[model samples]
Target: MKDTPRFAPDDRPSGGWGSLKAVAVSMFREEAPISTAHALLKQNKPGGFACVSCAWAKPAKPHAAEFCENGAKATAWELTDKRLPARFFETHTVSELQTWSDHDLEAGGRLTVPLRWDAGLDRYVEVSWEEAFAAIGAELRALQAEQAESVVFYASGRASLETSYMYQLLARLYGNNNLPDSSNMCHESTSVGLKQSLGVPVGTVTLDDFEHCDAVFFFGQNPGVNSPRMLHQLQDARRRGVPIVSFNPLRERGLVSFANPQSPLEMLTPAQTAISTQYLQVKNGGDIAAITGLCKWLIEGDDAALQSGARRLLDAAFIAEHTQGFEDFAAFVRRTEWAEIERESGLDRASLESAAATFAAAKSVICVYGMGLTQHRKGVLNVQMLTNLLLLGGHIGREGAGICPVRGHSNVQGQRTVGITEKPELAPLDRLAELYGFEPPRKKGLNTVEACEGVLDGSVRAFIGLGGNFVRAVPDTQRIEAAWQKLRLTVHIATKLNHSHLLPGEVSYLLPCLGRIEIDRQAGGAQTVSVEDSTGFMHASDGVAEPAEDTLRSEAAIVASIAQATLAPNPKVPWSQWVGDYALVRDAIEATWPEIFGDFNRRFRAPGGFQRPIPARHREWKTDSGKAHFATPADLRTDPDTPEPDADTLRLMTVRSDDQFNTTVYSLDDRFRGIYGTRMVLLMNAADIARLGLAEGAIVTAETAVNDGFHRAVAGLRVTTYDIPAGCAAGYFPECNPLMPLAHHAEGSKVPAAKAIPIRLRATKPA
Candidate 1:
């Protein structure tokens, strides 16, 4: 059976089927009208159809779903016809819904009407928008005596720029930057790391760069699950003889063989194109050691050509001018012995040598990474190490060679570009002050981790979520659930019901809004909303379909109403005017963020959204020395949360099945990896299974021992051995979310350590 490889290596986290095939047969089936809308979504026109999944930008050309398969699932869920009416609210109390699984609650579909629970009735009865808004307004009014920071405004990447901008503006005008955004969960490291290293917290490459790369190195990320559209780029690179090197704990489906539904021949013949040319299975929490080893070999080892490669590799010129603390960093890399690297990374010397040789051979190598590398003890340093590698290759400021952080939200980068960040430096804040004629808050706001902590401490009384499902995105969900309950009120302005929405506050409100596919027909003929893509390119998203309901408002319109009721109106720009014409809001954005936003709309009329100036794109590194210097080295001790070095205590990583993306669950079935009707199955190596005293399909319980003596029992987990390294095991997120404690976040970025959790396994109690 091992020689035959019955499961095709079964390296992908779970599911192997095409994300689209899964979405097409699942989400799209639930709503066929959306199939037509997806085609229009790809057109680079100014309407509201951007991806609802990770922030990897939508393509200039519209496809069936300008989004990926996971995106379709997210959009379908957002645009789902099914509704949770008074009957659903009647049958399921807030407490009951709280007990529902993340999948079941979100899959229950859109919550059309507002709901508020009454203790007398014990059920959430439908409430009018006026009453709901009025109640929320009253609650905020009650907090007038308290400092504004007491109320937290959580932003989602899925929110329209208009909504996000207005939301940020309202928070600032209201006198607190308590903006806890989705960035805190995923790419905070990219933002913090890049800003510290390069003075700008955005990606250095564009979609155009994908075509130019001779080789693309992906680590700790599965584009098939997180950003599957990236598969097209990887697939094309395969045709061009461009090698894609993938380093992750598990082999990914997109990195293995992907049959693009977009390709005619592939669809006809079901021919699968090969992706990752070299697959490196670095163990969980092993990225630091793996990356450091690559640096060591390339710099000092017998593969001395890499030094010349490093000459072409190192932006030495950029380093000399723009960086500091490198001599120390260099010394640190030298001290890291190959033996230590091999043992820690769980990679044989041959494999490491092969990988180093591949990098040496490639002329222009683009190193792309995701959360796995960024949500650890040394996440910030890990990112800098990537730049250091690129810098060593002199890859920056060149086409097809740079560092890319594949963000998950559709407009997450855009949100930051338009000043949605909690940590705004003096320059952006001054710009906002100059453009808006008001002093924007200069104080930094709480990241997602701190925001949750505030909730736990009772300092934050309210949580106003603009879009994302916060609870699932946060680590240590038990702590999050308990903390969120302490809030005086929680108002979620969302398109669908998520698990976070069900984590009830004393008083809660769920407001349904129009999705990107749905046209926001108002006094205007057609309305257009702006969205930023991965590369900091902002484009207009205009909805082609009518609003799902007359009662449902655009996110902008919803925010405007809340603004009108909640705060005293400011005169710089009328909130009502901005809502009526999103262009007015864009004008404000242009004024606030100049140089880049100059001629924003006109520039977008050309190709692939408007391009933001990456200082490095012009060889203008925004680093202090005006060059691209590597970051100061950090001492990344092993994760304190890592289990004791014992046979039973193993490091666990959370991953996505091919059928799902981010927080949204597409289906229980993962066809490609052969998982069916469950998310709790553990993927361990066959050897590890024997070592751990387990058998095939034996149900196990994951017990997480953390502070407060917390114990989370993940029951009915069928142990399925896969081609994984000996010490690492894998499971899906939000399901295993209970295993991660709130304190396990990276200290520098506070990004949740979802990819690495120290855990133990045991047999589940017999049913």
Candidate 2:
């Protein structure tokens, strides 16, 4: 491993010359030029494919160059000239490939054909698509015959609307609702919180809202790495003189100033638009406290401030008219003390008051958050508190004012909208059963956490992953992989090679599928899939580039074919017709979810597509109370109740490197964090490092603080000092995933508290 730890801070993270250089390097590595240029120009456009990196919506009138640097990287990676032929799989054993790094595994190139694992030879051998499908079908049928609930169908956020709809239909028809998805691991908290508070599970704002907002509050998100396209929106918000206040444990580059690559002056010069007007380094797991503190201040203002005619900090009229639980919420806020808030939030009263003052002064505001707020034990409450803050000032149902949850995957929200959920609503189920003569399962199914537990207990006999690297993406990596190995059958439908493919079951198969940027031609004609963005706009995504390999099947085709083979005699749904004409799937979707997806085919072809109905957008609450509700605050007494802190103990947060998106690592270098040629590094506060008697670049190991009597540790991580909050440390995920206990998840959402892992760091003794 290269040991060069560059400590220079990146003044310009995503855009400017840095983005250009990164783009050039990615194109060179992927051998992309004419094909990439042709493909990129169409990405996020009216007649183009959605970017695979993020769920940020395409502007109604997108420019010719609508894609960002990371989007370009994703496009190049998808449209790479390199190919992983059948011979390559034949030459390497599963165990041998397991030794390869994640980047190396993907660097092997795109998968082109179906391959089945041969236990005797310990290698994967090429198999015909028909034979592979037939074998998988037989196993699934056998499992269903014995116990229908013994199978799990997992989906990645990369799944398109048509594919997601088909996958869920197949799962429900196959007598199982064990449809765990990537959302469970990331934004499940957002879904649960929003649904409870605002009567909508998605953000209520559109792309145009950013332009009108006076201030944007970013909590626990690094947009530069997670969603680079959002930088443009932030840049525009900043240019409009809107103050952006950031609340994060770590000082993220994306939350700092950013140089826009699209701007001629900034691109040519060294100037950059400042992103955050104030950056508050809140402690890990302290988001709820911070937000609640702000609310408390807004409710019971300073004596001096109140005397200065700043009495109407809270929108009493809006709260009385459009919200509930104000009295109880205000009582809790008034009772909560400043010392406790300061201790939990790691921010003094001055800072919290300043942020609250900024919000109070603004007429229109948008509260934005990511996994940082959601991946906590109180994740759902964290989200609700933000909504409460917004409701106090009437930040919803108006231009430039609403809640925004920045999703990691390009179509994660879209997948949920199209019924890729384990918890199926009664309306959708009723509609589905009415349209297709199948009784949908009523029992609540296994989520990501429960699925892993099910696999371990030998209850889930078979597993089928639609696109994501499930093993690596979920928490408790080693344990989850071991449980995954216990499966009787495992199948992965994917576009590229991942570690999950190597950790197969007794009967394992890899089914290659077409990517988003590739042509998806069927018997009828070229097909287009629709996806819902973060803002709820449903748009068409048509591939402009040729397939990496002709043998690769569309995700829709694979799902439909699997359903056809598994439910052969008389499938409830028209699998063959759906595969042949994707429009049929859209028709089915519209029939099922008519309220939102009416005329999907006809409307999706419109310039910017159609917006999904959001009652919250129009200040119409669909909740039981018929108004937005202020949910109870999380029990802040829990963390403080723990015995005095140990010297070695630190709060660990699993974070993404700048070179990666989710589990896909584009490179080892984290340019923003100043780490190079390695993923095995821990970012710690400089003062914390000094107190622990550890020098910079010191090799260390972090052990999880779980009382479950199981030892979980990640070793050989080099500690690097940074400007994070004291008692808080951060590290790259998948690498740090092993340190997260599955049981340590949010109360309601079950999203692993990846951002608030209790860890004990120790010096790594020389071997």
Candidate 3:
């Protein structure tokens, strides 16, 4: 190992010299500082493209340097000078590459051309784009012939709006709605919860709202590594004396303190801005309990305040006008005892009441959360409880007050906005059929979890991944891979090589595509793609750097080509026409959602683009009762998706390293947690380690608490003592995914319970 594993308390700020050092190392590794420098200048700026790494909202009027360290790293990674030629693939066998780590595989560099798996030679052979597309089409056609439901079309967040719209259109035209996406694995819970509560699935707050907010509640998220750009906004909030409360299982460095690299004063001094005024270390799967506790406290306070004839803490007028089921919700909270709340949340009454007091004082509050809250069995319920808390303050629709589901990936929300959903809405389908002359499918399709189940049951035959490492990212790593192997064909359209590409199907095709920072040239010269940020800002992104390879196609072009190849005989839509002009795709999108995407092409070119109308943002509830609904605490039960663990079991949640984004590992070092040069380590509470009669740094095996007749074990994980809640442990995923079962997921969202897996650890022999 280059560096021995080290441990520190992570006392430093988030975006100071450490971020700069990491960015410099990444730029050096790419060996294209000049190109990367030019590209970085345009990143997240007006008249330029957005960063591919995250979906953090940018400033309306971007500063001279609006990009963050990770943004620079993401750009450099995409614009790296290294290239994988055809000869390299010929020299390396699939089995040989399988031995490489996920980082090492992608480190070999960007894919330069289309490659087809040669089963006979056990190596990938170069194939023309036309030939590869034809082969893929043939496989897809054959699968469709057997059963239209057999073919699953999957998309990742990296896909552009143009590509996502076209891909979904293609799937619907092909008589299938099997449009599974990365959202299925990430923020599906947020969508389901928010839609049920506020009648809108997207975030209600805007970038400008941050400046006016009185309080910000961050739940189950680490912005330091996941969304570094959010630190700038957070730091600004801190400076303005806004109270930021964090409810998480771990005390992440980003949420604790941050030094904005963009701030001159912060960079010049040792002083780091304190971010979280209150940090609640709620146990895994305890968010719903914690949030419910807060709600109950608020309910009690409001009731007392009403009895005294003092100013009511609750917004009585707003509740009466814009909310329903408040009486029932309040009754349930009053009936629920504090014993269960304290037992489940791992927190006492004092802390919950203190947080509630802070909420009662704040007029405008923003509640933001990430996968930590949604990757549990009660994920949807967790979110609904959060909404209930915000609703008490009449937080939705007011300035600086709303629910924000901070999504990963630059365009995951954009993918949905452009209609990349398993359940296609009737309005969009009808519009598409009227405008495009095709009968869009109405039946619900497979999600990420269901898609895997489909593969296992032989219901799904072909799998096409638009972008992302599906095999590695999904839960039950072995089972997912085995199911992929059974597929007739697997197509991966990506920039870099990863494990998913190595796990080839009977006839596999790897189609190389343009990265976000690469110029996308078609027959109509240069083209730009659009994406929506977490804040609902839809902006156009124009790539500055040259293409990694001329053979590589734009994501839009690839989807268009595939559609043309598969649906050729008098296709319903003009596939070739949209391939040459992305503006045409935008036109179709504008037509489909005229209210939301009016003048998409023209408005997208504006300074900061346009924000989608959020019904809840205007206090306009679009629910069945035309009002916001609060979930009763008693109504929520323990998530049935996760098996109840025995007394000896500990809940395990998967996290990402500071040096990585999603499944992309920049380096093995987790600088915040102070772990270095390895990904197979587990972060356990000191008490838990002692309880197991294990010493720190001891090699151990983690087995699932309950076995549902499926093999769920991840062995050889080095245990390290950390300040986590007792009986709770954390590990980085893709590595720890093997320990998670596919059947274990949130009931409503179907998102894998990655954050709350019941596990047990035992000491093992040193490697």
Candidate 4:
């Protein structure tokens, strides 16, 4: 390791020099100026790049330093100075780049020029925009003419709403709606779960409601690392003396303590504030048991009311008026013996009782979750169960209360908001068709999972990705790569290079676009793009930096340009003007959802941005029954899709390192976990290691046993001791991504079981 001084992350304000330097260096793939990353970080225009890191929501408040350590690294990765000049490819073949590490490939820098794969040389050769576009158009046209079911369009969450909106429109216009969005791989389960329970696949919390909550229940999420921007809100709640309980498998640093780099004095002392009052390390899949135990402890428990005859318990009135299936849910809970619950949760009755006590004592509480709570076979049931818990506590409607699902991307929710969905309702499409003066496809398009299958079977031929590394993001990497190879054409509008770019077809093109921080000036004087955060809060993002390269264009412009080139005649929506001036696009958005985007441009002018309509604030339940309900799963151990593993094997999962985003590699090291210089490692508990007869740092080979022609396996991974459950193992994604069989995804949602890989581990050079 180099003994160079790298900027360290702090909780207090010193212009975030450390994080800025780290981010800027990696982004441009160059060292223009160390301080450039820091100065640009605070710039309002610079803050809009969707955080370039995790899918964590960007707050509506436009925080002074809205970004975090991981977020900064994400931005730097995009803003990197490293450029893949023509010669860089001359030195390395496609085969060579394929063998390169994730970090090494990323460090090769931004793809400044477009290139097409040279089949004979087994490498990529530089190509002009005209030729590249013509080749891509020809392939797509051929596929369309054949009425090909073998073609799919994969959309990434990293894409701007404008890009996504245009991509889907282009596909549908060309007579195919095989749009497989990023949600297929990540939060599709959340949508399935929430939709089953609440009708809408979104959270119901308003930020203002946090002011009235008495306690917060954080489940299956790591806020400190995954959503560091949310820490400020939690800290505010803590200052107000509200109890914050965290239930996660790993005890992360972000939840323990955070030194706010934006604080005026905290940086001087390097002082850190403890965040969570209680950190309950629940075992994996233990969420079901833990939640059940908490609910049981609250309902049929020893403690009934507070001292002096006050009713400080479950809200029976609310449960009766605003919910259903309590009797069935309670009876089901009764069937779950405490012994089994304790065994699965790894928590004794006392711990369960204690956690319930926190919720029981509070009048109003908020439950916040992420993909962790919903990425299971019973993910839908899991969501309903959480809703039941909240409703039972009368924690809907007022301040400091309601359900908060921290969205990962700045506009993932927005993408859905603008109709970039697979299982989209007929009403939205009808409305879109009516407004656009074109016939929309009534046929159900393939989702993320279905898209991969279509590709592998030769039914899906061509692919046009608006950002996202679909090939890398999808599970069963070998299968997806093979499927991608069968495609007639592939096009990606990206900021940086990833494995997805290498998933070539007969024809392919990589178009680098301007980053969120860069100034996007076209025919218009300036441009502002709309993005919806996790909270359903939409805001305008203006670019802050000069364009890295002239060839680079705004996502809006590129989408419009492609649309104009591909679609015959002119579009009715003034695609060209919308590209240069996104306000007109916001106007179009406002026309679609008036209740949410009212005064689309005017209200966004406010310093602290506005929020979208939250029906939950009024205790409004949109389900058919008009009440929050509970669902009892038919069976707990009957996940046939992701069947239980053999005794000798463990259920493995793939997770991102603290420093890494979805499939993008910012740094090879994960400083927080003490992992460095490598990602080819697995994290498991010491007891699991000992039981498997393996010493620390032992090399092991792990491969998924799912028999579906899916080679979700990787050989020779180093083992590292971590604070995890006995039967569980975790390795960084895209590396361990090989273990997640595409067919073994969650049942109802079909989201790749990235968090639930059934695998066997064998020690190499066993001690």
lDDT scores for all predictions? Answer: 0.74, 0.87, 0.87, 0.71
TM-score for candidate 1, residues paired by index: 0.93
On TM-score, the candidate that comes out on top is 3
Candidate 2, which ten residues in sequence have the lowest lDDT sum?
636-645
Ranking, TM-score, top scorer first: 3, 2, 1, 4
What is candidate 2's local distance difference test score?
0.87
Per-residue lDDT tens digits for candidate 3, residues 175-232, read 8888888899989998898899999888898888898999999999899888988887
RMSD of each: 3.8, 1.8, 1.5, 3.5
Write down the TM-score of every candidate: 0.93, 0.97, 0.98, 0.92
Give the Å error, residue 688, model 4.
1.2
lDDT of 2 by residue, 276-323 (tens): 999999999888789988998888873345578856777778888999
Give candidate 3's whole-model lDDT: 0.87
Residue pairs that clash (backbone atoms under 3 angstroms), model 2: none
Candidate 4 C-alpha lDDT tens digits along 388-427: 7887787877666777887776578778777677664622
TM-score of 4: 0.92
The model with the greater TM-score, 3 or 4, is 3
- Poorly placed runs, candidate 4 (over 4 Å): 1-30, 38-50, 54-63, 302-312, 570-573, 638-646, 707-711
